[model samples]
Target chain A: MRGAAQSLKYLLLAAALAYPLMPFRDVYVLHVLVLIMVYMVLAMGLNILPGFCGLLDLGFVGFYGIGAYTAGLLTIHYNMSFWLIVPLAVLNGALFGVLLGAPTLRLVGDYFAIVTFGFSELVVLFLTNEIWLTRGPLGIPGIAPISLDVTWLATLLGVDERWRYAFRGEVPYYYLAMVMVALVFLVMTRVEDSRLGRAWLAIREDPMAAASCGVNLFAYKVIAFAVSTGIGALAGAFLARWTLFISPDMFKFWESFLVLCMVVLGGLGNIRGALVGSAILIALGEVLRVALPKLGLPAETRFLAYGLIMVVIMRFRPHGLFTQVAESTMQSSLIKDLRARIAARRTA
Target chain B: MLEQQLVNGFTLGLIYALIAVGYTMVYGVIELINFAHGEIYMLGAFLTLSFISMGLPLPLAVLLAMLAAAAIGVLLDIIAYRPLREAPRLAALITAIGMSIFLQNLAMIIWGSRPMPFPKQALPAFFSEPALTFSDVTISWMQIIIYAVALLLMVGLNLIITRTRVGTAMRALAQNQTAASLMGINVNRVISFTFALGSAMGAMAGIMVSMYYNTMYPTMGYLAGVKAFAAAVLGGIGSVPGAMLGGVVLGIAETLGAGYVSSPYRDGVAYAVMILVIIFRPSGLLGRAVTEKA
Candidate 1:
């Protein structure tokens, strides 16, 4: 049965990979799909800090912005290769994450959230005001697309000579994004099922109890933040290559909120749910951008709609759509075990 | 030169303190940051502008604006909060963020995105004119009014918090919710009253800020809200006097930083100060340290 289930999962994954290619393959649609995949990576990254570790991170976009700018600057200024710049961006992002997390990890609840929010604002302000380095509001343009040397391999395989792969086109990036997303998803799933994942969950449920049980709260929290930030940076590197642009406005607090909404809407701590959430949110935002004008609604009404959707979702389904079963099971078992342990200790 | 910046900072600080009081008071009583209070402040400014444009007397316009702002605050609690009384703190926090965004966008849709000028005729003739001056430094009569009014409001709030029966009940609730309930305190009523009081003060701040800046815009509340939130945090989240002190300190920091350093870097200085304070003195200047019960 387990082997059958495993095969079924692989089959579903294959179908998903094949489904996007079967359409008419317009570049616009393909670009949206690529964007969705990128955001899925980001949402998964954010989930590590906020969802699993129960840290409220309102400035997640700050690291993402850093990653994009780093990649953009390196490729545009130093003429670095895309493969080389991507890892550098991730490293830069992880270093920043550690810097931010180390000092603030001791704070509890809303204080930590506020500090993170402030950090995010500070980053954007820095990017905007540091004209010499960031070019202020003019933004960096002419970012190069990723180039792969797969042509020789294709020739070796005797593939069709008519196949021309342009770096600017969506086809090459789409496959690249798919591979990254799959890798991130696999790694996150492994981490979630590992000892580290349990430590994170324990800290999230009750930090004091977790600490009493020998889990290092501060270490795990900081690690979660660092890992999540590193992943966000990777997404940023791709985003710079895909759009060929990097601007401070793109890393606004609202972008962070959107990612948070995706995590919450899709069901926190669930990797597949984060993917679904990102797709739905990105699609809805695009649809609303187009539909509001046709409906004779003003542009600002879109924000109103966004706020309403979040409020409604939070009101009705606080645990989100996908994580209901796991939450309930965990809550019940936790309570039962606590009761039993306490009674046994009292009797002893 | 330093005195001039100090005066400017103090005036701005007073306005911030007025708004910060609302945030601190609500938080003190309920432990929930009332995010919509900033929107209430925005509504007050817009309502004042609307009434003055319609030729209402300035005082009457201000009064009507305050009432409207207070009503919106109460309505927010009724619709968004009352149902979620039993919900977790995170849920309430998310809802507050949602309400804040909703109010901002609703204002954008209703009032349009353009900045509206405050009606010149609404100001008293003497107050409209510039007052004291020291060489190039100039102080306006309007600044005096703002300082006086803010001080008066703070005193009035202090009286209510210390002297009134409702004030005692609020203190009781804040100290211990279950014990307060056991003591026959009407928790819901006191919470509602706290919201009303906080909203009124925030509205007053909004009115003063609009008159001071001579402009009102739909999205003006966001930056001010963040600054005020920073002030509240600086003073200690649940302390009233801390909010006032924090606001003044922030105001002074920004003003002096702008005068001595680049204007573009003034906000950066203020936030940097905030981060430093949080790292070194998390309880704030005057706030008592709190221990989590776990």
Candidate 2:
């Protein structure tokens, strides 16, 4: 039954991916979907650290900015290929994650959040003031887009570029993003099911007991930070490619907060919940941006509305819409079933 | 030249210490960081500016601003915090962040995003003028007023905490919440009073900051709040004198860093100091190490 359910889930995901390629799709809808995927990727990365590890990182965007800038500079200035620069960006982000997490992970609770907040602001300030590299506020422009010569592959398959328009336009990127998201989801699922994920939960629930049980709290936390930040950098690279422009404005403290909201709203540490959360938030932002102008609402009033919505959400659903429960017991039940199956096989 | 930097750093440090006191006191008592306190500081500036714009005298305006800020602080506790007293710490933390964002956006809606120029003419002519100068170092009368006001406020706070019965109750609550409650102390009232006191101090800091900079913007409190938070942590989050010490140290570090190193790196220097302090001395300079009860 479990195997069948898992297969059904994957099948549904595949169907959803293929649906975007269908004709008659509105360009604006495609655009919103692409953005939703982007945020989903970013929020998932953040979830590993803050949601799974229970580290309140108010400056998660620092890693995102680092990744975006890394890809932007390498491609724009050094004229490196997009494929070549992506890995470097992720590595750069992970390196900084280690640098930040190494010293600060020792501090727990609100102190950790404060340090991360400072780190995020420092990154923005650096990007703003250091005109020599970042070009300050003017920002980097004309970033090359990702292009692939799939005409030969198409010819082999007897398909024309016109039919491939969907792929070239938004469909391919959507699938690519989906693939990355799926891969992250798988890795996170495996990690969360493993002893390491349990260690994180143990630390989150009761650090003292976890410590008594021989969990190396600092080591696991740094690992989670490095992994999450590395993935955030990957998302940044994708964002640079998608927007085809890189600027300090793209990565700010508010961006981090938005990702946090997505995680909290969806249900921390729950992948499906995060996807739903990102979709809802990005949709709300887009709708507000478009609808408010038509409704004759002042531009600033939208921000006020956004703030009020956040306060309301926080006030009512502090645990988020989807509560993250301990999954270990469920895993144990599955393990017991598997063991029983093996014993029955031996008896038969 | 270094002396000027030192003086400037000390002045900035005092202002940070003033704000840090509220953070440390609240954290010491309830373990909540009160993220909205920074917004209260911003409100203090806005309230002061509003009162002065309404043709109130400068001193009277300042007093009114402080009182308004204190009242808001008390109101915040009553509305947002008091109900969440028994909830998880993370819940309260989220609410505080939410409140901070709400207050900031509210301010933006009420006052335009553009900065407002603080009226220098509202003060006495002599107070508005530069009072002292040395070779390449000019000290304004306003700076003197800021220093005097901040020092007096800190001293008064110290006296209130040490000598007064209310101060004794506050200390008792900080040490142990349940015990304090059992002793018939109105824990809710004490907490509200803490917020009010802290808000008043933050308001004073905001006013002095506007005078020092000669302008105020909606987002000014964000950075100042972060710096003040760093100061509070550096002094040990729950220690008053420690906050003062941390603020001065951070201020000096920031100013001297801008003077000697690149000005662009001043903020980095301050944060670096905070990171180093947290890494090496997690308890802060004056803070007592707390062990979690099982």
Candidate 3:
């Protein structure tokens, strides 16, 4: 059964990879898939907090807005390459993360949540009021699409034509978003097995006990905040480039709540659950958007459904669809090898 | 001009205090943020509108609406929050947010998404007229009514908390739930009463604001709730008197900040104050220090 389940997973992944190239591919469907990927990255980023560190961060979208506006402003003002803008945006996000986290991390659970919320609202206020920088309520438009400038290689080969390939269609963005999701997933799974991840888990389980065990709780939490917000910014950078227009409304508090909902619905502390949660909720939102109008209700009322899903899930499945956290660490080859060696020794 | 701002700020401050008291009292007893409290306030306005349209007098409509708001609050505690009492705090908080969204959207679907004017026909003819004029400052009759109603409800609330048996039980529960229950305080009943009282005060605030502004919408609660929660935090969570003082201070600051500083960043003032208070003085001005429990 396990072998079959593993095969099914790989088969689905293969199909997903090939779907965009298929003759029957729909533009609308491709757009939704890409949108889902953006949220997937966000869910993984947010999973680091409530899932791993047991800190409920309510202002995660603040970092997302920061990253997006950074990318948008840079592209419009300097016409910088996406490659250069990405690192800059991520660093900017991490900087803000540390700045906000250092002073506020000392607060416990509920207090910490409220402060994060206040910070996000302030972010929105800044975005809306700073007309000189963010373009205020009108939003920044005409951000250049990401392009591959491989002209350097062509010049080395003495080619006549330029080798620039600017993204013009959804197909290129679809693949790029998939690559982004994969990279984020890889980093999350790897970190979950690292010492840093374990330190976070210890902090979440018991701060006092973890402190007695010599773990620097404050330092680890700040690190988690930096990493999490950095990833959130990365996703935001992708969003700005993909949509080609960035607005303050796009990063409202509701967006943070929606992403948090995705993380919780998938199960806190479960990385794969985050991916599943994003896919499910985003797909559900699309369906509601289309079906609500047919049912004589406005599409915005879809939040009502999202809210119901959260309450029902919290009541019936609080741990989410999956229960085991750090499940990847136990399945590592090294751990499996140790198990085998121990069994062999006992048998001898 | 400063005096005018002060008078306007004072009226706004009184409403915030009424709402802030609800947040503080609930937090004191249950340690939950009760995000849906703002939705209750919105519902109060809508319910009053509905009652008034049904041919009920203005006073009767307001009274019925507050009662309904109180019942909804009790039901909210029973249905959504009661089961999560022993669960993790994160779960309860998420559920509270979910309920808030659900209630807000439900109100939208019922009332339509447009802003509705509070029935002007139901209001007294003189509410829009100025009642007092001193130098350059003017106080409207609506402002006077708001002051009177807010003061009355707050005083009534204070009497309940200080002089009643249930009030003592609530304080006992806030200090230590297990001990209070051990003393046969009927923990859940006091909690329900607390929710009922707070929701009624919040309802009155909503009603007055809708009357004052002559408009209300489904999303109005989101901003008000955040500002009031900020007020609650500024007063120090779990402290009623502290919440009142914090609300007044925040309202005056916000009004004066809007008047003198950038009007575009008026809403930002509450958020900035909340974050600063939480970071620098987590205990707030009137509350005890908050330390993480083992």
Candidate 4:
């Protein structure tokens, strides 16, 4: 019954994915969809660390800014193409992860969380105050749009140059984000199925026990941080190119907190849950953006909604709307069934 | 210039100490970081403003505001925290964050976001007059009162914890809740009392801060709260004297950093010092070495 329900859920999800890819495109709808995809990618990066590894990173957006600025700066100063800057941004992000993860080695729980929060605020301050490098609050504008050079393909196929296009339109960016999301989802799933993933879960469940079992806690934690950073940076780089502008104001503690909310709202330790949470919240934001102003409400109400939702979700469903592994449920039921069987045998 | 800055820093440190004591006492008892403590401070300031605006006497207004903040702090515990007692630590932490955000937004909704000049008339006539003047350094009656009142509160808090029966109950609960409860101490009541006491102190700090800065806003809590949390950590998270010591040290460091280093990064300087302290001494300066129970 559970398997059938899961398959049905997947079938509907597949249809939903296909609906957006249809030839007919609404710019406004596609814009929202693109944002959802972007947030999903970012949330998935965070999902891996806090969800799988159980390390709460309050400064995930610092790596994100590092990635965006890496791509953004190279585009502005070096005239490097978006394609070329992607790998560089990811490397910088991973390096930052190592720098941050190392200090957090001895830390645990709330202490680690506060340190990360401080680090995030420091990052924004650095970006804002360092006017010489980042153009300060003025922001970098007119970043060259990413383009696919298909002229060679056009010549070979005897087709027109119309086949070549820059990734500026909403539909193309949507496809770009979808491809990235698929890649991250695939990698996350494989990693989650691997030994490292199990180790993280073990650590999350009981750090002492995991350490007793010979899992090098520090190394595994760093790997999780680095991987999350790399993926998050990729999303940031994409955001920079897609938006064609960069500013310190765009990356705030609120953004990091919102992403954390997404991970928590979706089931932590579950990949699909992050997607669901991100989609729903981003959709809600887009709707609120249009409607709240019309109702003559202050703009700060959005944060109020986020905070209220977090409180409600946590109070009612502590594990979140979605939950962790099915194996736990199966194991508990199996134990119950075995206990019953033993009782029956004794009676006989 | 140096003297003036030092004077300002010293006064600010005392204020931060007042807020830090709340964090330490609550943490010592419940081990929960009350993120909304700052918002409680914000509320106290706003409430005091409202009371003063309504023609209430200053002393009565301040007392009522503190009580109201205590009540709201209790409400926060009941709403955002009580249900998740046995849940994961992360849930409580998230709830605290949510509560912080909620209170900030609630304040914004209640009092518009613009910074308002603190009502000078709310203070007594003597507070409006300068009490002392040194070469290049001037101190007002209000500053003197802030020190005197804050010191009195701290001393009173110390006395209550060390000398009184409720203080003994709090100490017992902090050491071991289950054992304390077994010994006839109402654990829930003790916890609620700890929150109330801490929040009352925080409210008083808020009034002091609004007077010190002479400006009050809805979002004022975020920075002050974080700084006070840092103070609590630096002195020793659960140690009362540590919070006091840490707040002074942090306030001085921040003020010095602003004076000597870049003013824009003065806030970051506090965090840098905090991160360094955390790395070198995780138990904090005054915190005892805790052996992690497996």
Clash pairs (backbone) in predicted model 4: none
> Predictions ranked by lDDT, top down?
3, 4, 1, 2
Model 4 segments more than 4 A misplaced? A1-24, A150-164, A324-348, B125-129, B291-294
- For candidate 3, lDDT tens digit of each residue in A1-348? 768868998999999999988999999999999999999999999999999999999999999999999999999999999989999999999999999999999888998898889898899999999999999989999999999999999989999779999998899999999999999999988887788887898898788989999999999999999999999999989999999999999989999999999998889878888998999999999999999989888788999988888888889998797654334434567655864686699699
Model 4 C-alpha lDDT per residue in residues B192-268, reported as the tens digit of each score: 88889999999999998888778899989988998999999899888999999999888888898899889878889
What does the lDDT read for residue B197 in candidate 1?
86
| Candidate 1 vs candidate 4, TM-score winner | 4
DockQ of each: 0.59, 0.42, 0.75, 0.63
Worst 10 residues of 2 chain A by lDDT: A323-332
**Cα RMSDs of all predictions?**
4.2, 5.6, 3.5, 3.8
Residue A319, model 3: lDDT of 79
lDDT of 2 by residue, A137-202 (tens): 888888777765457787888887632232256777877778778787778778777888778877
Query: Which 10 residues in a row give candidate 1 chain A its minimum summed lDDT?
Result: A324-333
Candidates, ranked, DockQ: 3, 4, 1, 2
Measured as a fraction from 0 to 1, the native contacts recovered by model 3 come to 0.74
For candidate 2, write residues B1-294 as lDDT tens digits.
988888888889888999999999999888888888888889889999999899999989999999999999999888887778876556677667767777876787677678998887786778667688888777788789888999999999999999998898999999999999999999988888899999999999998888888788777777788788889889988999999888888888888889999897777876777777777887998999854444
Q: List, residue by residue over A123-211, the lDDT tens digit for candidate 4.
A: 88889889999988888899887887768888899976766577767767877888899999888777776778878887887899899
Number of backbone collisions per candidate: 0, 0, 0, 0
As for candidate 3, its clashing pairs are none
Model 1 CAPRI quality: medium
lDDT of 1 by residue, B100-214 (tens): 8889888887787789878878887787577988887778999989988999989999899899999899889878888999999988889888888889889999999988888
* lDDT preference between candidates 1 and 4, better one: 4
